[model samples]
Target chain A: MRSSLILCTATRFLLPIILMFSFFILLRGHNEPGGGFIGGLVAASAFALYAISHGVTYAQQLLKVNPINLIASGLIIALSSGLFAVFNGSNFMQGYWSEFKFPVIGKIGTPLIFDIGVYFLVLGIALLIIFSLAEEEEEIQ
Target chain B: MNLIVLPVILPLLFAVIMLFAWKYISLQRILNLVGSLILLIVSVLLFTTVLSDGVQSLHLGNWKAPFGIVFAADILSSVMVLISSIIAFTTALYSFSTIDNERESFGYYPLLNTLIMGINGAFLTGDVFNLYVWFEVMLISSFVLLVLGGTRNQLEGGIKYFTLNLISSAFFLAAVGLLYGLTGTLNMADLSEKIKLAGDNGLITVISIFFLISFGIKSAVFPLYFWLPSSYHTPPSPVSAIFAGLLTKVGVYSLIRMFTLVFTVNSEFLTNIILIVAVFTMVTGVFGAASQNEIRKILSFHIISQIGYMIMGLGLYSVLGIAGAVFYLIHHIIVKTNLFFIGGLIQKLQGTYELKKLGGLYKVYPIIGLLFLIPALSLAGIPPLSGFWAKFLIVKAGLELQEILVVVISLFVSLLTLFSMTKIWNEVFWKPAPKDNPEISFKHFTLSKKIMIFSPIVFLAILTVIIGFSVEEVFQIANQSANELLNPINYINKVLGRF
Candidate 1:
């Protein structure tokens, strides 16, 4: 499959915006319908789009790390977020909100950390699938 | 710090650590070994705590029961977790020698821990949806494990296993959705109470059948068991051993839990159906085993047959019967896994799994033959072995219930199991090697590899012998679990904190 110059130029412009929007969705997920899963998907689509416009190798170079490691780190982060409650003398995954509030993100808490973990994990998984399939297609061609 | 969560969390933790340490094979191996040992220790602690404390529960996010997800462990859950950890540990040891570097580097250790996490989560979760999630975790990891080597046979078998299990999961999800719609709760204890109040026995019965089909496919009962023989023998031996030991048993575990806890209202009819399924599963499984020419295939079929006895116990529906089922479950896991381990060892030594191509194992290695005899005899329900006690309990419970037909069928199946075992022994051990069979020896393995493989088989064989010799103590544990199962009121109270 040959990449179009127009498509490549559009991806170059749209990638950062899509990634930023995914983070927005992830942050808003605490109160709204969106969460780590959707946000991660959005972020993954950004990279996926870049892979489609450019190439698998270019996308991998851009990502700079293996997606599997991303998944592993995401899992650790998510689990540690849950562990915060255990450290606080409560059951696993108990939510404990702090009194301080941030300007843009509002309240920074374990739930946000959990969502970040999910975001990384979802992004990793989606990218892994996309990259593998794309590379396989490249091979077949 | 909640003890209940450790069984699930520790595996996830170890899996992650191993994932990051993937490039270093030695590090992964050490991590896998240490993780299994740690899981074993934690499960033992969880088991002891549950035994002494009656019932332990942890409500996630501090969400009280009937609302938030809860992880609960009574005697049954704790015992299953403990036994599963033992298998995980031994399978880890077995894998050290048996699994090749290709598979190990292909994320085998992480996947194994992930599978254990899923199994433990299924055993411990108090919420139905949570159980479904755990099942998915198990299935995903198993799917990868099944096809990790990417051999043609592995891929073929993996597809069958994957498709069937996916359908089963769909059914389970449908049942969960329907139940939640009908009763507005997913917690097992809450569902029990709400199911009693809902008074919609007809729909509930329909949901129960959906569950029966779902879990039935999983446990390999009767018509649904075709997947077991086709795919189980295709994976590597350690993989097969773990799968044989734990996967179907998780289904059986879910069956016992759901039927006892939430679906008890319509059990009279359901149990009658279970009894018929159990008998057919036994006869067909043994017959399948007898017809098989290979080692793992025979053992695979026998897994189905042995699952029959556990279902039979549930069908009996008394404290003694359920206890019998529990004992059979524990006994079957140890014996079946050991048999598969021995099968692997046989392949290692003789370079063939085909009984027709193999022979003279007994003459060459008497100790290996003795090791094989212990599990083989126990599996055949010979006296002074664990399987005998397990069978005795189920048969005794059936007699008390006057279910003479199942009892007779069970005994006949036992004879057939013996026949299958002896067929293996005669071909693989007793008879001389056929002409043109390549000569092979156990010394082909390095010393540490030999110890790695043999120690786990020996450990499990010893466990079988211990359970056999100390039937009273094991039975006492099973009986206690049975009583708790029979009386879910205590469980309900403990989880909901009504007391």
Candidate 2:
């Protein structure tokens, strides 16, 4: 195996940049292109890179909670954002837009928030499917 | 703004909350049981509202149709929602007695809740693509539950199940793609109007056949049925019970909805094909049922046969035919699930769902044997029970249509159904128990398990009796749903804003 120095250096140097770009992709999703699903996939890719260099055991140890819980949480958030319309006396999954302007952030709506939830859900489910399957592959090792 | 969205929302929220409390058995159990009870109330509220007001809709985020999402509830949908959740509620109760502690710890409640979410979402969705997503969600969750044990039997069965389903999904996706290209819209109501305007054509038939192949695999109709008996038998009791109870019925429900709404214009071609499929499906399925030695496996084969009766109603494509199908669906869903649960009870009491290994249950638990007998003969379509009425409507529809061959096949199938039920009685309850076998004792059951398992079966079995006695009211409800399905302008206007 390669030395731990190479792996640690890669994760430390690359993770923040990857996360920043993921948010960039998510924020621009409504008009220009990149959306929650793609952003989530990108963020998950960063984690995959980390898990690879650091070893899955280290990644599991570093994770505060299980990936499956993240998936459930994401589903709740995504579903709730849609249902909020119902509670608000609007129709289900009817996009609720709110106008906002910020110094750093450009604009946001319930769509963006919903997108964030979808992002997290996709990321979590992807990781869960990948890592578990990987672990199973390793168990057979 | 429609009221259709709440039923989907509340359970999805519960599914998430239930996940957090999965470590605490008591908390998860409370949440799931309470969650399903909440669903039942929500469904009832929806049904009563829709019954009065007709179909209601909520456009997501106040977005207008053809632009943003729409969630809808109609009289037909709301009633089905009620039936589905009530079944889920009862099954959750059944799970308490059947699932081991390890299953509880493995996020069972959360997954089950989510599975219901997927099921409800599929039922309630107004859009076709959204239906596909929800179908995948339910199927994936179900696949996990099927393979939860990872035992040799489960793995073997899981592989078969997954392969069959993966092929189905590929076809489903292709059909969706083709339909999108043809219609340029994924909304079901919108597609209906457009399709009617365009009129029935060869391309539409191609798309419809694609869907039939996809759903037929799921429904396990005729030749697509082998995967079901082998695979459904491998899951644990709760899985088997719920799978037996609700999932395949979802396939049948969608098939009924789609054909009536989108594909029935070519009545001679499509309807005649469905009739033949129904006939073949019934004969083959009953033959399979007659041949089986295992309990749930036999019941599994019978699900295919019963789907034939439902198809008969649909294939006839009349008010009487569809109403009969709807009534039969409601009857079959409850009775079949009850029989499966009785199979579970048989397993609990006798330690097997095998006919060869079980006998003389009438001596020890005569009440259970009685409870069991009502559903068994009812399933066999004997008179004065709910099953007879369901079949009566379909057979009457056939006679009205003068489809003598189809009607004759339906009769032969019912006779075979009776033959198989008698086979079960002779093997399981009438004969003496084996001398060497140990009997299940009271010590084996906990109080919660008893309430959870027995109550729902008893309640549903009673409802079956009530439906039989109250055939007029049941027929009215079915007739109303069928009228709405046939004259979909009501559903169409409600969803697409009177265009």
What DockQ results do all the predictions give, each relative to the true complex? 0.76, 0.59
Per-residue lDDT value at B24 in model 2 = 79
The residue pairs in collision within model 2 are A91-B58, A92-B60, A93-B60, A94-B60, A94-B61, A95-B60, A95-B61, B2-B57, B2-B58
TM-score of 2: 0.95
Q: A1-141, model 1: which lDDT tens digit per residue? A: 678999999999999999999999999998988989999999999999999999999999999999989999999999999999998899899887778988987878899899999999999999989999999999999
In order, the candidates keep a fraction of the true contacts of 0.89, 0.75
TM-score of each: 0.97, 0.95
- TM-score for the A-chain in each candidate structure: 0.96, 0.87
iRMS of each prediction: 1.4, 2.3
Residue-level lDDT of model 2, residues B256-334, one tens digit each, is 8788777765667888888888898999999999999999989999999999898889889999999999898888888
Provide the lDDT at B296 for model 1: 98
Q: Which TM-score does chain B of candidate 1 obtain?
A: 0.99
Best by TM-score: 1
